[model samples]
Target: SAVISQKPSRDICQRGTSLTIQCQVDSQVTMMFWYRQQPGQSLTLIATANQGSEATYESGFVIDKFPISRPNLTFSTLTVSNMSPEDSSIYLCSVGGGAGGTTRNEQFFGPGTRLTVL
Candidate 1:
């Protein structure tokens, strides 16, 4: 199993500012994913970060607004750019738990970074 952690457990920021959240894994994992959970909503898949490649973002999410970097197998970062009040939500980092890093595998989530835009 992998132990995952996130920086800035929670933060309150003003509108139009940006916040970069970091995710670190204790062990090297093959597939990492970024997700967003809006208030009272289910988790939304933001992007998939594979080491040595550009992140693949889901629909409704763009690299311009949410840039992701997978510098290594054990770490990744997600930056919310030019954040607005609507961006206020919980952002999470997760890694595939099954062999070969497939979607069928279970996902281990990091203690999310909560952002509140004022």
Candidate 2:
């Protein structure tokens, strides 16, 4: 088990701007992922940040728009570029439990970065 933390729990951004959110896990995790949740909508997987490789973005999400960086297994950053009213949403960072288990693993999520684009 680990403690996951995100910075700037909530923020108000201007149009055409950008916000970078950081995620720190207490210990090395097997996997790290980023997600986005629109108002009144369910969570959408943004990408999976690899420890040493480029992040894998999901459909509809591009690297240029949502650049991710995972310097190590314990830290990652996600930048939401070119913000707009439609980009207003809660961004989340999650880390999977460490290895060495045969049972199902649970991913722990950070509080989340809430951005309201104006």
Candidate 3:
């Protein structure tokens, strides 16, 4: 099991501004993923941060808009660039379980950082 933490449980930002959130893990992990949950919406994978490599973003996301950094095995950061009211959502960090030959892919999510744009 892995424990994760995210900064700014909630924030209100104006349009066209950006916010960078930090994520820390208790143990080393192979992949760290970012997600966004809008009001009354399902969680959506934003990107996957792999240490020593550039982040792999999901469709409709670009590095210029949602840059991610994984400096080490246990820490990462995600920045929401050029924000808009449409970008208001709860951001979450997740880590998958199981190691070595185990194929378990269970993901544990953070409490989430809720953002409201005005």
Q: Return the top candidate by TM-score.
A: 1
- TM-scores for all candidates: the values are 0.93, 0.92, 0.93
Arranged by lDDT with the best first, the candidates are 1, 2, 3
Q: After superposition, how far is residue 9 of candidate 3 from its true place, in Å?
A: 0.7
Determine the C-alpha RMSD for candidate 1 after optimal superposition of all C-alphas: 1.9
Give candidate 2 misplaced runs (Cα > 4 Å). 97-104
| Residue range 15-86, candidate 1, lDDT tens digits | 888899999998888789999999999999999999999999999999999999899889999999998999
Per-candidate total of colliding backbone pairs: 0, 0, 0
Point out the worst 10-residue segment of candidate 2 by lDDT. Answer: 96-105
| Candidate 3 Cα outliers beyond 4 Å, as residue runs | 97-103
lDDT of 2 by residue, 7-115 (tens): 9899999999989999998887657889999999999999988788889899999999999989887899999999989999999998874532211377788999999
Error of 3 at 7 (Å): 0.1
Strongest candidate by lDDT? 1
Clashes of 2: 0
Compose the digit string of candidate 3's lDDT tens values, residues 1-118: 7778899888999999999988888888878889999999999999998889999999999999999999998888899989999999999998884542223678766778999989
Q: Which residue pairs does candidate 3 place in steric collision?
A: none
Stronger candidate by lDDT (1 vs 3): 1
**RMSD of candidates 1 onward, in order:** 1.9, 2.0, 1.9
- Candidate with the larger lDDT of 1 and 2: 1
